[model samples]
Target: MLTKAGWILSAPASVEDVRLEWEDGSPPGDRFGEAKARARRLLPWRTGAERYPAYSSALVQLAGRSQLYDGDLYRPTAIAGEANGIRLRFTHGRYFEHLDTTEILAYEAASRDLAGRTPADGRYRRWLKDPFDLTRRSTGLGTVTLTIRTAAGSAGFYMHKRDADQLAVGAGVVHAVPAGEFTPSDIGLEAIRADFDLWRTVMREYAEEFLDLEEAYGRGGRPLDYDHDWPFGSLNEARESGGLRLYVLGVGLDVLTWKPELLLVCLIDGAVFDRIFADMVTAGKEGTIIAGPRGNGIPFEFSNISRYVDSENTRGAAKACLTLAWRHRAALGIVSDVDS
Candidate 1:
């Protein structure tokens, strides 16, 4: 189990060993039709706007927005732990469908006192226990990452405090930087089919969150070429050359929102990290970047992790990413990667 994060359904696993695949199709209907109906009635939802007042008002005030298209998303269909590692699958899903489901559920739970207590009288938590539940508790995937910067004799990671006004779940909470929904690069069929890889979503978020670049998926009615894209190309090359490393700590749902999260972390060579994020924006669409350790992140150390992980302000997935990364630092080459 991911101790601090309380991953509902997981054991010890690693990203280097997990195999992932996706197909275009519909997943079974979620079991939350009744729950959604109840939550809406219990909360003060804006009638026609289809959002809670706080979430709706925040979006109206934001100066810049990250995404124009709600678009399609890859819904988790299955996850099987194999002898070698883990196997995960996804299917096609609509954006608004999720907003109307788990998004609203998160707001409902938060509005009540059910934030951390799962299975509270066999309610929302029961539905989320089985991540691959056919009744699909969640329709969207959270590709949240702990962005690590490996420097000479030192290493640390970045943090993002989500805008409570805009985000329904884990609002104003600290999270790993480059966090985003697992979705396709474009709204087209082909893009939906092609952008299922986990790294693609991570890279797109990095380009937007760190560099403040426009969303890197196919823009201008053109297909995105990962090999030629500025940040994606650089990130891929660095990984190939052993200058950057990607690892998956595990997958689970955030207790507050019960939203599925493919918890992950990326370690980058200091030189490469510096170069890529040299012009990093202090603020982006999601919220302000917590500049720390006198730089872009908090120090990835025991004290910092302990304080944050145990705090009520940190998101479950973010804490899980940090806790697992620290526990597996050796296998991840986190410390040695820089000195080497």
Candidate 2:
């Protein structure tokens, strides 16, 4: 029978669970360990790039402020309650791309890389050149002044040009007055909210599937009759498969954010797993693999066996786990040893 704690632990056991956690806790984490752990679990399976491709609408607030400054700027704004404009200026030879925009292809254009001549003629041009004009005929968006500078001393602004039609689908517009004139208001806050919500959902689903796979695989090994009341009992069941079982554990935000690449590393090296298992035992969270097998009816115990150590060993182990997950992006769907 699944208890309340089991259900709570299992709540984020799958990708779908992770998603629901995020939806309930926008930007989560402020609540401390609970909300943050859910967020980290979901991050590995986030479809944020797919849902909010090109640029996040949440960033429009910053764009609104950008217009107040002088020079070439790429600011996303709404216009006339009908279209969204990504305003930007070109400065030097380099161009900027939108975070939401997907890069499809890149190829070298003909030689237009000179100081005096317009680089725009070569399919790419420095923003500093005067009389620089480029048009996205399909989107009805065009560029006029090529060279402009910000007070901060930045040389160029890059932008992702989107069609008015595509921009209208994500958000609505409001009215703002400036200098005695009225202009359409930018409400990208909604877009950002929606994008984040969608990402949370994707992460939860992934966690669920991962747990399911782990259970199915465990069943294929040995069957150990273990206590259902104790959380540690599940560890004994996992031992039949050679020290493997579904165990649900929480991780920290620092580990998730700064060491995202570590997920990929652990997956590649089995030794990383050994280190983590050892650490858990040392932390006084010991359990067994079978109850009735031994003469005293105790389970098999595994210990931390690493001789070579360092101050950052735990950090390294965490990084390895993160690296493994990242490397096997597809394997996130596999069953997790963690219960729930």
Candidate 3:
């Protein structure tokens, strides 16, 4: 088979259902930084920042806005699962270093080491024995959610067209809506403790991507009061009401950067979805909301699933998510109007 490279170790369970465990591990020294430093000494004349100035600046702006925080994010250090349950082990990882190695690859003519390997070839992922290596690189754990609106007999899902200028990876591509890197809602230790949960991270993204709420949630120097906040409060209440259903399909790695993603699906009753997202925006910080027939969600039928899964433009993470969702549609209670 002419196969494409994907997840290094994908379990039968999704990240959400896993019995997750974590170690508050300290920073693993940066492999990319060491390489960059070595390059600075070996061939100081040609530097990444100097050569890729435009791309570097855009990344700089993204980091400056705290969108790419240098703080700790959950790293899936280990995984063990079966048809019954999945147990995942995690550790604290440096958010900045992950971007340094992964996102920086998108820039044209990025750093090439003494051996003449460039970022185009994923030289940053060299430290690990494998592309999904966890040794020196800060392997990130992000979330990708496929939004399905279950409006009684008719059910469909929503997608997003990520803006090219938004970030380095997965940019300018169509992806499932409300996808994001897992991070704390605010700065400091309190947020670190509170936002550590996977569901919290997913809900926060919904607030940001769905409602177009300001991304700077923790700028006020206080942990996000999810119980008191607008979208967060409403989101929690809706979850309790059993109107919104969140499911995780599995996890996968990017063939390019080697980062892992927690693939998820948000199945919401059409009325509940509409009421909660009454003020939903068409486009915001992430990208434009892609609609389906007559501006509704793209049908969740077999044809639409096959169309996206077969399309080259759909992000690989999305393809995996949609493929898995379609496979388990009956389990997820997805009521398709057309053929299965």
Candidate 4:
């Protein structure tokens, strides 16, 4: 079986790693101020429609197969030929809709019926009880799990439980910062030039979560024009200055959703991490960083992330995800051990 973390695209053939620094006119400072201000105005995160909107196109089905290049010979399996997938239209940067439990219930019924008649391994047969993870891991829905690293180490974030979230009400989970669904906006579309790029989703989440630019910009509901020299410039600045290094660590399933999560590790210069961390701490102390409504935002330093997991504060699935990622600390540019 192909290991989930084997499909790392950290360095694609066409990508060149260049050191970038923002000089006189850049987004970090005076150079790209106008553009940053403009892109901030373009955010539409919380404005999702209540009803299911139209997809840009019809769903497309394809054969599903898993592959990994780890210097070992591979043989195709019968399951590879039997499995298939359908591409659902993107959420288009809208807030995540509530997970419809209808699918889970149906899968459970089908699995139970099959289990009664078939002779299968206990592990495979028992999966009917955990329908959420069974569908997530087996069906291959995609997600993005971003691990934020700073000089002090990786940063931890808290998720506020909401109706839309999978966790139970009043529960909290400690997660790597800015983890979210990989959207078409992250990849780019012909109709929307603004969101067209691989880094769009990651950096956009960074801006919204850490920078608080979304609420700040969406405050007045004021309309603003597009500024071409946008998010990319700021990203370039981060990459060039050695403040940020993004890696596609590999793919893994969220234990709860059983969805395919694209593991992305983001390393931030220690100084940059400290600055953001301190600011969030200040925000939390001032009660400016609300924890509810969407899950209050609680920030944790890299050194203390283990507390949540050990204390059982985080959900079981998130705990599994974090534990798996922590095993790759050195690869993710993290220097400390998982427990430390």
Candidate 5:
């Protein structure tokens, strides 16, 4: 059964051994910066990027600092899988996302290495519960377990699915053999794991970029425009700080993309617009968006930004639509309507 299960050889004796082999030897600070840059580069494709600038700006204005980390308060990389069906593997030292009652039982069962060599009947039953429920209820979600067997012994990992996919998708059983044993069949799982870690580091860095932009804007007293290279920086900050204020005039679909459109009629009306614009100019900052009865009027509705997507497929598609709106904000009168 073990051989039929397609399990491979065990890994090195200790996690430290794996780390020694995989550590990039770079300073943590520099490594973090590089990771953020990569994440920023990928932002154009993700909705998080578009919202990040505004969210971070708001955080700065209200909280005085942008959120740098999720502060999940649990070990990172414990749960592994796509949206659902995520399995947590804990024995290998990864501990994140608190576990719930069901998962706790499973952990106990797996720990016992029971008579059947899997999990006991009751524990196995809990394991079968919906992974989402287990995750949602639990404070910490565990890791996914993979067992590999070889001539020497058995090894496993509580690793992310992406890392597992990278390995399993390849042609052969890739073992991370120590410096001594070398074979084509032997691939280093540590290398793959390191790659996954690097990817996450980059994502956090990208988040920080927007956070910094928000800080700079808030410090400038919520400017409409700044000397920054990105023209959208000031406006993005203002929207986030609630200084600009967004009013939904109306929502409709773009005939081409089938994506939603949010109409902006104007920033400020007569007296309010003049007052705020003059104040901003005097403060050496550009003006902000102020829409209302004088500009667009009350009950002016725009597409619900938060309800943009309902499912994963639509999530990606909706983002593509939003990207179009962001790029064409000026040409389509969105910018003029708001900024004017």
Candidate 6:
């Protein structure tokens, strides 16, 4: 039976029970907060790119209505009213339990090389358990495509171009925003055994990438008018339009980082979304909006999926994400066939 502890994957004798253990091996340090702060400072450029001093090691996957469809096609699972968090426990033998310092460094190096980026400098401490290292069972990072739907129910997806400082996976290719790993800050260390906190990652990313937390807070204003603390509460009250709908699209393996990743779709009221986008794209607010190929500003800056799908520059897991988003546009509630 599925319980708070974990769901049963098989009969008792043969399968291991869902388990949660501290990655005691993560290089000791209190740099998690500092790393997060630095990444926050970078915004869309390298948000969460710095190798933090340490982080909680946890596995993430779909559950309780969210499921992977045929490996490629994304069947988005939508949940509303309140945030839905999926808690998954691994009973498999492949999830690594421990790693020596030397092994951790080697994994980090390989991860950088594979992603076509430089090794982590001393900016922040390195996460002992590298999710990019596919050799080991890395933490499951979640990437979300926040969709803005018009009053007419037509949906628009926001994709950004990766800058030089970011990983090479899709450097120039346009891809979704508000994506990152599920760190301990997202899922509390104490509660790791009870839940994976998937939705929390979405909310946090939404605020950071899409809403610009620093500016929002600077104005004594909160995105979505959300008056809450970290690991946010129910975002339903903050919804501006028809309401917020979250869909667990599918999973894609990052060929560059060698980590398993989850792609999610978030639908919000178009009017509210446009207002936020407008605020960021005004004449003096260029940097506030992330631009890419084709154009370098707001609505004009957003690229169509078709234009980049076949481009040689768009490759790797990001390419997979673009293809999936486009393939499932109709299922994702996108109404405009012309734009899709």
Which candidate leads the pack in lDDT? 1
**Candidate 4: where is the Cα deviation over 4 Å?**
1-98, 101-149, 152-172, 185-196, 215-232, 274-303, 311-321, 337-340
Q: Comparing candidate 1 with candidate 3, which one achieves the higher TM-score?
A: 3
lDDT of 6 by residue, 33-62 (tens): 333344232122222564322211211121
Report the candidate with higher TM-score, 2 versus 3: 3
Give the poorly placed runs of model 2, Cα more than 4 Å off: 1-13, 19-187, 198-251, 255-318, 322-340
lDDT of 3 by residue, 301-332 (tens): 88888888888889888888888787777788
lDDT of each: 0.67, 0.19, 0.67, 0.35, 0.24, 0.37
Q: Show model 1 residue runs off by greater than 4 Å.
A: 1-16, 28-69, 114-138, 216-220, 294-296, 336-340
Q: Estimate each model's TM-score.
A: 0.80, 0.17, 0.81, 0.46, 0.17, 0.49
32-104: candidate 2 lDDT, tens digit per residue: 2232222222112226553222222323332332212111111211111101111122111100121121110
Better of 5 and 6 by lDDT: 6
lDDT for predicted candidate 4 compared with the true structure: 0.35
Q: Is candidate 1 or candidate 5 better by TM-score?
A: 1
lDDT of 6: 0.37
Candidate 3 off by > 4 Å: 1-16, 27-58, 61-71, 105-127, 217-220, 293-295
How much does candidate 6 score in TM-score?
0.49
1-340 per-residue lDDT for model 5 (tens digits): 0011111112111111111122333322222222223223211122543532222232334335332221222222222222212122211111111222222333335444644555444433333333322121222211111111111121111101112211111112221110000001112343224323311221122122212222221112322222242424443454355433322122222221111222221122233323333322111111111122332222211232222323232223223233333344444233222221
Compared with the true structure, what per-residue lDDT tens digits does model 1 show for residues 201-312? 8888988888778764444377788997787798889888978877776777565555677778888888988777788887876678876766746776788778878988
Residue 291 displacement in candidate 3 (angstroms): 2.8
Residue 169 in candidate 1, Cα distance off native in Å: 3.7
Candidate 1 clashes between residue pairs 3 or more apart in a chain or in different chains: 30-135
Candidate No. with top TM-score? 3
